[model samples]
Target: MDLFTLTVVNAFIALVATGVLAMQGQADRQFRYQRYFLLAGGCMLLNAGISAIHFSGILLPYWLIPALTNSLSVGASLALAAGIHRHLQKPGKRFGLLLVFILLFVLHLTEFARSDINHRFLISIPVVLLLNLWCISMLWQHRKTELGKVYLAFIATFAFNILQFVFRTTFMVLEQHQIIQTSIAPVVHNVGFFALTAFAILVFCCIILLSHSQQRQMLQQLSERDALTGLLNRRTLELRLNAEFSRCQRNNSTLCLLLLDADYFKQINDKLGHATGDLAVQHIAKIADQQLRDYDLLFRYGGEEFLLCLPDTDLPAALQIAERLRLAINSAPLFTPQPYFLTVSIGVASSKDSQSWQTLLQQADQALYLAKHQGRNQVQSYQPTAAVSR
Candidate 1:
């Protein structure tokens, strides 16, 4: 509508964004990026507050208003870039960012900047455009990641702000050079402020969507993974096992199952504590993970027990892999309050020998029982007649 009304709307939106980000920071203390976003919102609020005060016909020094508002606007943009950097797990250049703000503030105080509003826009808008471009480049670098698509809205909002700044700058220059009517300048300026208000709303919505998506992914991971060892849990294993079974059946390829159990895990828990026992299991899981291929899937089948799904592997290769895992766990030492040696008994079963994934798992379990029966810390292959030790 009008400049004063638009300024009031911008201030109200900034206030709401600041409050929401503050609550978000409190809700998730571990999300460090939220703090930076909160700072950005605060800067926006301060910038809008100054604009509102200036437009209200308050008697104030002429240069103070534009200089303070422009610097705070740039500070808000820099804060947004810093938040994005932190969200991506990158270190922020705090000193460099502070120095940029100082430079902008000092430049705003110059006679050249104070003499003409167009000069001030030329000085400040390019810096805002560059920060927006920097943010776009960083987000583009991670465009293929799991949350890449989620960043699209964020990127588009910044891109739109950049275009609005360019458009405002062009009209400001035209008004300064008498190329456009002076009346047209205020309308263009009002449109720019409106665009900024829309940008703030869009950015806030994108932040909410991004946070919701992240939390949902984290919850899904927790549901599908073992809380102790961070390995896939049995619940997820069933789905993956069935999928692999169907794929192998259609392609006539082999799928192997290796059932691994920690030897004397209860003894470690009894001698030390349950915490030490957890450490022992984690040690075994880590060693086994290091010994397996990238495509191999490891699952926590039970307490002190893990199951591995090896796709396109025959009995012989599966046996070799099982033996390698066994040796790796046997040699690795678990360092806890009391150091102890960890070992695992692995059983190998191939899809070719069984009719279904369940039967294959049963055969591997039987082979694992035979390995423990014979002695711990060994690998056994399931045969129709009997289990052969390897």
Candidate 2:
């Protein structure tokens, strides 16, 4: 299609994108990046509107049209980059992006930029290319995170836009040097505009998908995690425990469970208030988390109890870990109204001595009873004879 037709189509697309993004931003106010994307869509719409007006033979100033359109185009690109940075929770190059727009606007005002279309293309397209590259780099760096794989679509879209810009730049250079036929120039320019419109659609779709995916993941985590301690909840325990149990059964490896309970948690709540009681639980949880290995799974098993699943760990090693956790909690001071130190009683049980995870959990619970029965601040290992005797 011709330039006017392409400009009209682009304007319509930008208008739709701006409206959709505005609704999305309003609906999901928590997604801060959506605001930046809304700004980008608005800028693109303005840019497309100006281009349509310029091509429609509306009488506008010689330099004013190009200046406005180029500045808005560059602003849209910068907004896209800013949104990506925000999505990744990275610091944005705000001052630098502003400087780039300032420089581009100044260049557009110059007689050099207004005198030739090629000069304008050379001035503005490279700025956009660099911004696109910056966005790709930011997304690439974070491509391994939980939501990183979803960014592949975004990266591919930006990469395609980069190539499209390069292609346009090449055509503009060849035309500037009088290497390409005049008849072919409009075709290349229209192709560039078409590519740009397609890119705008693809990138915004990717953003919407990413936002939904992130929201879904957050909801899933909230469902499976303890609200207070931020550890795995009992709801997730059975699934994880069964998996670990089967793995150990097949490999003949050991899987140990350390059932931990905060000592005198009720007293802290009754005397210092439930708020401090909550703090006490949090304190013990924090200490246990710090003392454990990365592969170990910690869960908030009860009001003031935590369960640690240590795969491939023997009973002796589990006991040592349990003792270390007990000591760590005993030493840590919780700032209460009165002077008080938090402690935990840990019960260790190994899968090697049990037929199933249920039996193992029972063994750990019985051992926990023994530790509390003996006194509140010690680690105890499950012994079959001792448990039977109890």
Candidate 3:
């Protein structure tokens, strides 16, 4: 290969590798189907460099071509298949999908070794098209989404390159046996091969960029999740509740808030130290979380108090959940030296379309005062029309 050709291919590969590295650095989730974009992009760049070196005709054996090609092809195909399945929430279908590729690719390689690339192309071209079509079609189901649009672009670019390969591979082997006209075959095959390689790198790089954008979004969500309680932290709850409160006011819907404090939490702290206190709170949160529905928002409001927001849940249901949580805490002892028990006080408040979050919290606090007033371990509801007791 000429220096110019080598330089162009290497530069393109380097660009793809750079994109994959940038995406991997930004990946936030422990594992996501999109992260495979980074993994596969990096592999392709390295493989491209190897192929470019081989193109220079450094006297490698015939076996190396099919061997190396099939090896990399197997890996890339599997990665893509698994990633696509997971991205589409079809993980249960992964093995069946993978088996199709394995059968087609293995047969294609076996025919190529014995019968030459031209004969193999007769089998592989239409089959490869169908395989590629299947993968792209799956992602096309997601075209109504933003991320799906990204994968669609990937399929478009990749499908074009695969078609180019079928054409180029057919001509190269045909020219070898003088089955085609002499003059145009070499130029067309060389040009097509280089162009397909470049296009494939470009497609892989674009997938990396799209994956990185998605990863950033997940990172933002993760920052809002509480580590201990698996609930939204105070800050995220405040932001969400404020927005929900505004909507409730416009629509005249009821919004409820529950304030809860663990009774004698300080005793856990004094007797068992801060670690047990933390454990106690975490255990209580886990139990409380089970009683609420998925749409309800739970938060470690601050220190020993937890706040729960139940949209459309009226005073009665709010009080019911609170009391259930209160009793649940009392029934379970947090390993308190065989005799001690754990209990919590809960205050419930609900209003019809209250816009002010601050005032709603104030009312919940007042209800908590009523709970403390009645006794330490009980549930209380706020009544705005009633006079405040001194």
C-alpha TM-score for every candidate: 0.89, 0.91, 0.73
Q: Of 1 and 2, which scores higher on lDDT?
A: 2
Residue 358 of model 3: what lDDT?
81
TM-score winner: 2
Residue 349 error, candidate 3, Å? 1.6
- What number of backbone clashes does candidate 2 have, counting pairs of residues 3 or more apart or in separate chains? 0
Give lDDT tens digits, candidate 1, residues 104-218: 9999999999888878887889999999999898898888878888788789989999998888888877777889889777778788998999988988888878887888888
Q: Please give the CA lDDT of all the candidate structures.
A: 0.87, 0.88, 0.70
Per-residue alpha-carbon lDDT of model 2 for 202-310, expressed as tens digits? 9889888898898999999999999999999999999999999999999999999999998888888888899998888888888889999998999999999999999
Task: Quote model 1's TM-score.
Answer: 0.89
Model 3 alpha-carbon miss at residue 374, Å: 1.2
Which pairs in model 2 have colliding backbones?
Answer: none
Ranking by lDDT: 2, 1, 3
Residue 226, model 3: lDDT of: 77
Worst 10 residues of 1 by lDDT: 330-339
